[model samples]
Target: PPEPPTGVPPLDPVDPRYIGPFRLVGRLGAGGMGVVYAGLDDRDRRVAVKCVHRVLATDTDFRERFTREVKLVRRVRAACVPDFFGADTGAEVPWLATEYVPGPTLADFVRTRGPLSGQALAEFAHGVAEALTAIHAAGVVHRDLKPGNVILAPDGPKVLDFGIARATDGTALTRTGGLVGTPGWISPEQYRGAPATDRSDVFAWAGLVVHAATGRGPFGSGTSDVVVSRVLSEPPSLLGVPVHLHAVLHRALSKAPEARPTAAQLQQAVAGLPGTERHADAGSPNRTWAAVSVPLTDPREWIRGAPRKRSWARRHRTALTAVSGVLALALVVGLGVRALTGEDSSLPGEPSGPGGTTGGSAATGGTTSAAGAPDDAPEEYRDLYETGEVVVEPASQDEPVLVRRLEPSSDGGEPLDQLRIDFSEAVSGEFVDFRMTIDLEYLPDHGSLTVHSNEFLGLRAITPGQENLDFRTVGNTGLLAELTPDDPTETVRLTFSGGVAAVYFVPLETRARAQESLDYPGGFCVPRSMSGVSETREVETFPGRDYIGPLDTTLTNGAPLDNCAYTEDSEYQ
Candidate 1:
């Protein structure tokens, strides 16, 4: 008897009554090519039903591919993959059923939250590796190993959707010019028109690992074209990955197919991994034939740029501003108001009294103010406000347009520095109002600013003002402010000399938390260092700089220490 079609109308007009001896219960998941339904077998066991798309059921090529996938999946029976139950080939929609496993997919889980941690990620990798081993053993290539395909059931990981997979001996189903699999996870070999293999699965797995670690793909976020370019031309860097597991992931992401470990090798290597969760001798029924309604072959069509992180500051700028007063302490030191801490008159190096630094001479006063408080209001409004002194631009008497003074602590206290400048009290004109000063042991000759995701870091120093500045690091990391303000001038500036000094400007509470985890690596307050010092050094004319390529090395080495490179590189897989 022909089994009644599942709930997807037109394909299955009648409600699905039974699939083989199993009684159809409800729908579990759905996709472009199929819909997964919950069902129960003869012994009243729960099962998943995957009903193929009607379009594919009518198309000879799709039908052949679907038939081949069902047969191939039957050969791989392991804990890592859903158990293959039975296929209702007799149904017009060609449904497959597998044991029902409850849990969110790795993709959905990450989407709802973010990336998984080191230990959980490691175990996830191990489980998937084992699954791929079983599939490869049957001479089938999964072709796709993205987070979307892995189900995080209560028991263990279950690899799903072998719809586009190719059997070693089966004929090609996709057209000659057609591309298969997710572009971000696609291996270099795939782009070069090389045959897909177990190694290709490894490459895709590495991309998923990156996504799982940083809540992002290794090459950053973008359209399929951008992601493909990165995979083909660029080498993968495991930034944001835990330092301990860097070596393990490098091997999996190697560009060269021959360079990567085989599924069995990867499985064995990860099996004894130190930090992993395991289940006892529990038995899980095969559910590979489960009814699923996901678009199996059109991955390229569904690939989307990872969602962008919206700044909490931008949404509630006013609330952020209020809270920012509390948080702004880390961001600004001297500009605090009563509502905010009212500006501190004792900024780094201002001489005492009006006769001291402000009014020494319109000549000395102008220069000193320029060097001391560039943002000071014009003398016209000296009494306009209580603390109406400029904190950003200083008087010209301050010497260099941007002067940094550092007083190193002999007692090993916090390294504190100050900048005193005085600009026109003129609240008018196109005044570029911003200040970035740091105190330390020394400064570097050249530097760059790196804006990754939401955080921005001024890596080094070329000069003090716009007259001679180097914009080398502006777009090096491909962080071109896709959604926010693109102009760097609008954002805060960070002026610092090259030197080692423990500096943090996070919220006081966050700063305390960071101090507590000084030894732990990763995340904010982890005590990452930069390369630069501010001690006495010969002044050199700042030079215009050129673009430095992407920093594609280990997180510790490639990323600047003060404004210089000091960390070591990791082995490329």
Candidate 2:
């Protein structure tokens, strides 16, 4: 058998034979907490189990954090992270295991393969950006995003080590004045004792991108205080990075989090670098992905360079959780959440054996199609998944439906613009009975959205031969007609068919003057495919310009009704 990316280290005599239910075969790595061992289940499925030290296992705070880590992974359903199997946090040793992703860390990859440049570096940037996008999309911030935490598997880069990741609901595991994260990669806000938000992760992303391109981090390695000082004051060391990436890295490394572009935006920008191979124009055929074929069992991927463990969990092994009651309460409400699509769980026809990185660029409109769809197929979200519920409008020669929304007030006010979609081209056909998903970047706290058409704002239901067909959603158990300020509501997913093509947001309670800004939801239109396999093509941050009222005339000839063209909601105040 070929040696893997994370080589199996021989077990120490003191290591336990089993952590939880799996029988330990060998050790992968060790940290202050405990040993990470290669294990096997009764069926002999391989797993990487991290068993915590007994002394800390009994600690309530550590145990709770470990449980929270499990919860975090459970909620995150992204391909850029390791596949999660199971964890027994309550076990005496408290070990957590995941589908052991086989690949060298970014640190190891660049070190061995030499610094990545050209297309490979750009692809790496896109992969890590997608990983961060997935992490932030799940309401978590990866506080430590150095090269070590990034694994270069067969299927692009996977972001691991959620030990320091904090939920966006303000549920920080760290105490004020106390710090977390590695030195060089830590964001300026983190050094100043500000909270770790999505932008903080972006800053670290900038550092990691720089680090991956060149051997050293953007700030170079140093003692905590020295690195923190430079990170707060000095510009990033982007001398060796490609010139095209300079602008993005500069923006991402901005001292002020407000100035940073989002990971999704970064994915959009970096993937379009000059060296990246161009594809078909939008609405054109030839949807290809950027995939690498490093197998899980490849000896090159599994070669252990060194143990690189850096997270709050790894460093502060015995640290107590000073998480406030309010934060804890918020986390309880936000635990185990699926994003806008509600389809974070595994996708259909996942390529087994080797790393399952497929063909296509992350910048390409949507998610990568697994199988069944030939290259000549339509770019739809339905065909990508083997099983999942969605509603896709059939391809029609007539006018196509388009939806748009004005971003909420930058100051957190009411619905300043219109939310509308022209459903005049609503399709009715047996072949169109496919599932579709509309993913928004940010789902607001309250959902007062009302779907309307040229005729009415909301429709009752679609009647296909008097069957009363309704779009089925797996997660949105209740179609919330009303939401409060404390509501954990984030994603706005529409399960309706041709009539309600899109949703409009009207915040009922965005009260008080805003000292901080809110993230606008992401938009991506998944076209219907004959097969259930589809890709997640990202759309604009908001539909269009901030709070544009609406378009005066109707769109024509299959032209997209840009969000700016959408008229204001007449039913809304």
Candidate 3:
């Protein structure tokens, strides 16, 4: 027949040549349930055929549950769902066939291309919601609605693999005392041993969208126990998610199943979003997804272009804990909490160090200046550096640090606003670098600051009861800071309806050194000879501002510096 699709591995020696009326051409993938093969029907139409493993095929309970779910899956008719063809439940090795969708999984897409944004992100969310609407309407709950199950085709996104799905009224066939879903994507109620429902799928959908937008699950990455614990207690970190869609997703991820919106309501909310009109208007009539007849490109070509560096098993090992009833037992004994917090026993809102400064060095705690600035700071910009917090010594080169909190503050004067960032551990002066750039062309002025650290790990917001802060600078400047942490370098974009005239760098320690000198020789309000330095310059539009940067300097242990500040001006150029 047509040459097997590239990236489709050749069938193994023990593989069957045929399953019912379809000819197995190549192996697509294998999972806990069975092996999926690329096959062709008598008419030569390509299909994805999933055959139940022999071990599972011998289990009468599994066979009965599979048959029931198969009937429910057949009832699902949606444009965003692959067309189900047929199945043979009575075969020696039961198999089901569906349309062969040639595309990368959403997990692969996001990992390779970075997180989706703007219209693309909106379309992806809307399409998946539409799929859920159709599935739920058919009385089925896709217990596992994760990034791996969504395929990103050129036409649109398609939800795949209903292998773990079941009818709303159907009895689950999970092994006794075992949980039935992926850890990070599974709902809290599911972990609590509740039956999977439509609302549970909604919780998973929100998590999938979060993963698509942030390149990480809502609960963050870790061992299964850690992720499960975070899902049960810690709030999701939506730092990189678009601000507008946060509310709906947050509501959808509510711990209470009754509190979450239904699939239909979720579809409507997603379709009604501000920038999703194009996708919304293109919605299929009768709420059914039309199969795209367009020929797919050779998978080999694209697969080579963006190689999947991590195998499915390797990537999900930590999240694939086959949770047993003992999970509740472990939680009861505080194992979950201990695992969640790791060796660092500090909890949210706990005192990080001396002086209330989150990352202050307890060993050499010192008082602040009269103006609230660190006592060792330069006299010229002391007020600008003051934050009413105790100052600590500079961190050593190997100490790991992270941005633990971000908030707005005043510099005790006019025209300048500050967005203070606190670290989980004291920042290593010798290994940290800061660079800020501003762009004034957009209606709401925007710019970015890069915080690069050799010892930087990731973000960890420790403010109790507040996982995320409202985007606001002093005077309600409407200043929003969106942090995208990519390990070693975290970029924070500042968007506001005002102008930024200058940017300053202040290390909290009394003794810090510079890895390199500042770029702007005369831009500093305070002498460069001092640890703390500032850059004053005119603001310019897009291309013009592209070349202008506040400064780029790496701090080392030497002179005292404390934090960074951005001063706004009405007459900024």
Clashes of each: 97, 39, 17
For each candidate, what is the lDDT? 0.45, 0.47, 0.51
Q: After best superposition, candidate 3 residue 545: deviation in angstroms? A: 65
lDDT of 3 by residue, 55-125 (tens): 77777777787877776676566778887766767677888788778778888777776777776788788
TM-score ranking, best first = 3, 2, 1
Q: What is the TM-score of each predicted model, taking all chains together?
A: 0.45, 0.48, 0.49
Better of 1 and 2 by TM-score: 2
Misplaced by over 4 Å in model 3 are 1-3, 167-177, 279-573
Candidate with best TM-score: 3
